[model samples]
Target chain A: MTHILLRHRDIPDINTLNVYKKNGGFAAFKKAVTKMKPAEVTEVVKNSGLRGRGGAGFPTGMKWAFIDKNNWPHYVVANADESEPGTFKDREIMEGNPFQFLEGVAIASYAIGANAAYVYLRGEFWELAAFLDEKIAEMEEAGYLGEDLFGTDYSLKIYTHLGAGAYICGEETALLESLEGKRGQPRVRPPFPPSYGLYGKPTIVNNVETLTNVPLILANGADWYKSMGTVDSAGVKIFSLSGRVRKPGNYELPFGTTFRQLIYEYGMGIQEGRPVKAIMPAGASSSLIAVDDKVLDTPMDYAAVRTLGADLGSASVIVLDDTVSMDWVVNKTIHFFKHESCGKCTTCREGNYWMRNLTERIHSGKGTGADVDLLLNVAKQMQGKCLCALGEFSTMAVVTGIERFPQDFKQAVRSNS
Target chain B: MSLEKKYPKEVKQLLAKYPPEHKRSAVMPLLYLAQREEGYITREAMQDIARILEITETEVASIVGFYTLYHDKKEGKYRMQVCTDLPCALRGADEFLDNLCANLGIKVGETTEDGLVTLESVMCLAACDRAPMFQTQGPRRHQVSRVHDRGPHHGIGRGVEEE
Candidate 1:
């Protein structure tokens, strides 16, 4: 099947403006700006049932409609900070099918009545940002961006902002703070970005992949998109397949594609034909899913994966084979979260630090069985206390690893007896 | 020597990205500009940026301290950050990093004797498929080097030569 999000795979040179235009790029944005009312655009998207691809799985159209109508000079900030551990799909989309993603940004801006938009890319993506800056300029020159877009009073200007390395900034509130030139730490939630964001104004913060789905939804009606993926997940998703796989790369498959198909078929089975032991369905943030035949055969979707006690977050399926152990895996994830905790909330900052120490001790075979129990207790304590999801995500691997793979931890820790 | 006198055009363009009232938002890109010359943000550059954005010097310094990319000390002309996170480590990124450090005769977070490259182990860079991959932050640009196909030695040699 031809790619919807990763369109560049099907058509080469799609990164070039002329080539993209030839293949029907920006037509959706043009149609939305010239003909449809902003409310109508939101209504279509609402019917389509597209969810944010940035792990949270929040409804996209509802988010756009939440923009405070009373507020003036609304803004749209694209969360291009694709810093998740096994996730590389957004980078590919931005680098390959950039025009499509940018057009999605344009359509989103029109729907939310945002006049200015910002694409917050992680600092590591410097080259990609420069590439996208050129794309934005091309859109401006072609009259798809800048003042009076498509000969309508609804004008839009999109800018690209670079974030210095901070994983916590991927959180929408923290992203807004970083975009405002403050330290990238998440804000207290009662007032989310829609009500108060980016300089205390109503802003719609959409993920790069989520925004990329907009133009296509606007061009082809809602039902066309709803028809593709499962009932719960109503569109194709780019599964970032990695770890212990022969073909570890981005696979843009429709939702409800079974894990067996993604891992064995597209991913070409585990590396060296090893039997699959586990799966980190959402990178390091996932609760490690113990892979039995039933788990492997399960359909990959937001709700379906939940039945297996995991979210198919961002669909970054990191396959783990028998060669790997859950103890070592938990250590790696704890280290990542510890380094990226942002020190905003005491719970996350201190919890990750302690978890890192415990995991290090456990993995290095320096800890007793009591240390394993203590680690699990600490992780469970930190589950719901964080100001943002980062802290909660930090505990997923720890709690799940200890509960599901007791033998791994039992072997990892030295016996006190 | 200062950012304003060194690159007036770049500074002006950075400030123009945000609104006049919120020019403080230009602090990040401005800090990047300031770091362009010395490979790290200097004391004077921070002051200059603080003045440019009308933010306090502590505000500017706090940003550099908080984010990993912005450095205060001048260690090397090129910062070679290797991702040894879980996904990359699965593909021998840890072994690759250890080998590269051995080849350079410097440990991770240590700069070469010639002050040319500083080696650092970073978290996942989102390029998990391309394991043993790294990004080089030079005085001018950040370039991601994928050495999955080629060995680490070859990729490191190619990276140092190109930069």
Candidate 2:
């Protein structure tokens, strides 16, 4: 039960240099620079099976490997824009254990042979960004960062970039656009960040939680790191539990920890002891899973959530009780995606607007069965056609709500009539 | 200072995006710069921006008027934007707004008569869980300077409270 990915949760004040160093922090960077090669570091991460915690569970090592070596002066951009509803794990890590996060960024940059790295944070994280800047300066003073780190030729300088309060910037490409001082919108894929990113240079973008695991991966070795969680999804994850929970906060557990243990044991069950109706396992963007015993017992991980028809995105588990309405939940989520839509792509821009109108009508009791069907069709059409996951993700709640909680919509429609 | 001289570098760089004959492509960045300097785009500033961009005053005005982020009128020293979207609203943003209005001694869409603060409701600010949050945009350390400058211009605006 030792913490792997989220070791800082157990260690006190890991944000401080002394506390962090005491807990075997930056030893990874020292070892990686002095002993291991860049490719070897990436191979360790790849072998450990660490995936991106930023909704898209992409392999971290594969993302680094994808960087076009032909493109010189490659960049590393950490997606710290944790704007997904019910997601606050990154915020906690950045605020509570900043040094570890910074060291992770440094290690990732070193592993990918990136001389410069940027942590693109949400605008609300202005304070966190400033704090991180101070931490980066501290790292520089400690000789863990900057040119000739630990007497090697590997030079890395980490910078913190702020997004202008756009959720779309959480998308890797969109993050690059914002970092380049443009509007926060997603660029077309196929030439992903690894090929062409900030300023059209090869870039590797990793999530905050994903990079935070790097220090441990190097400190403990691949097998030791992989031993904590399920086979496919190794290491501990910080599940940000919120909404109607008596003891709502972040709970660090190994991946594949059951939803029941998280909700009841960690979250202390519902606030008023109300029956748990549904669980949005991955924030507003996740499909609403009916909180039956089966789902409660289902382990919390990428593959486990897949069996329940959802992804363990960011592991932002929002527990909903019977008092909350599914229609209302869908309406809230729709409103968010609609407002945050950068309007760069035709489908997400127009489709989200259309879906919002339908969700509002349905939730307000003004919608009919045909309206519901049309909403579903619009969401379906919007899938696979978006320039980024924001567009594709906007559909999860809508599709799942209608499919799993039809009675709620029917009741809302009936009430309106 | 004139808008052209204030942002000559930015204007020139942005203008290079278009052909010399099509200097109008720099209109957006010009307006953005103007607003950044003056806090809000006035009619005269818009006219100057249009002149620099080689576009009509009406074109500049229309573009400035379109985006809600761009203010056509003079904003108060502090601009408070509260998110009124569903997530925030459900989380008692309305009550928080009422409390804010009462505390600030002004209603929504109205600036304090002394111009200390302009209050407006935004559609969303992207932070749902941190609901009932409002952003105060102005010089973070110039509250005294702003109050003293506007104290003689007008008295405080009317305070409306909903019971």
- Using DockQ as the measure, which candidate wins? 1
TM-score of chain A of 1: 0.99
lDDT of 1 by residue, A1-417 (tens): 988989888899999999999988888888888889999999999999999999999999999889899977789999999999999989999989999999998888889898899999998888888889989998889999888776778888899999999999999999999999999999998698888999999999989999888888888999999999999999999999989999999999899999999999998898788999999999999999999999999999899999999988888888889989999999999999999999989999999889999999989889889999999999999988989988999999999999999999998875651
DockQ measured for candidate 1: 0.75
lDDT of each: 0.89, 0.76
The TM-score values for the models, in the order shown, are 0.98, 0.82
What is the number of backbone collisions in each predicted candidate, taken in the order shown?
A: 0, 0
Q: Candidate 2 lDDT, tens digit per residue, A117-174?
A: 8788775565677678788888889888878878878898887765546777788887
RMSD of 2: 6.6
Find the 10 residues in a row with the least total lDDT in model 1 chain A. Answer: A408-417
Q: List the residue pairs that clash in candidate 1.
A: none
Best by lDDT: 1
TM-score for candidate 1, residues paired by index: 0.98
- TM-score for the second chain in candidate 2? 0.75
